[model samples]
Target: MAVKTIDDTENYTIEWDEEIGAIVFTWDKYVSGATFREGCEALLDAIKRRDAAKVLTDTRGINAHDAEDQQWMQTEWMPRALDVGLEYSAVVHPDSVISEMDVESILEGMEHSGAEPLVTSDMAEAREWTAEK
Candidate 1:
């Protein structure tokens, strides 16, 4: 059977580095009619295939998303993370509104688990944080 390619993407930025085991994502470009959660789930699944548990999402390049997207990420996506033992990380501009909301969404996930996401404007800092014990 054919798999779910929810949408045929064009401008999305997604890459995985096997050497570093990092799933890098840059979602600054918006594509209409594509659900953000589906994109992320595809990414998460892709990274999981190679046991890449660390992620650094760049949200500075795109527009802000709605509450449903945020709730979907925090409530639905995060809980599923337990299955892969993933550690979340992010590199976001300090002034991006979407960045703030994403951090807040991750914080909401903390209520469900002791695990808190590491976020920073510096990519290195976020990567280091995610790498910590």
Candidate 2:
């Protein structure tokens, strides 16, 4: 599918890749609600189109975005993702404050919602973890 961009005050992009499944926040920027929602939507779309696919959220700018938004995503969006068929094997990003969240909170949210995310530092690790074992 073609890359979709949402101008929700925050800058972000979403795309569906046959290989990666879902690619969210394909920029070197911070995370935001707009980005998270777009991602949640993209995951849902991927689930509908494809099967349970991994997600890659380029989080190079996690520090640049509002912390509350990130927390909200962790609390709210993650659960929503699980409700769908989105099984997120990993989250690609560098070490940042965002990584400090309780894995249980994130996983519980994902489990309650539909995704099972394995947060990582980059695409390589995320891909490796998500790859069918």
Best by TM-score: 1
Against the true structure, candidate 2 reaches a TM-score of: 0.60
Tell me model 1's lDDT, rounded to 2 decimals: 0.61
- Residue by residue across 20-40, what tens digits does model 2's lDDT show? 445454544544566656655
State model 2's lDDT: 0.53
TM-score of each: 0.71, 0.60
TM-score of 1: 0.71
Q: Whole-model Cα lDDT per candidate?
A: 0.61, 0.53
lDDT of 1 by residue, 34-62 (tens): 45676777767765675766766766666
Q: Which ranges of candidate 2 are over 4 A from the true structure?
A: 1-10, 22-28, 31-52, 96-115
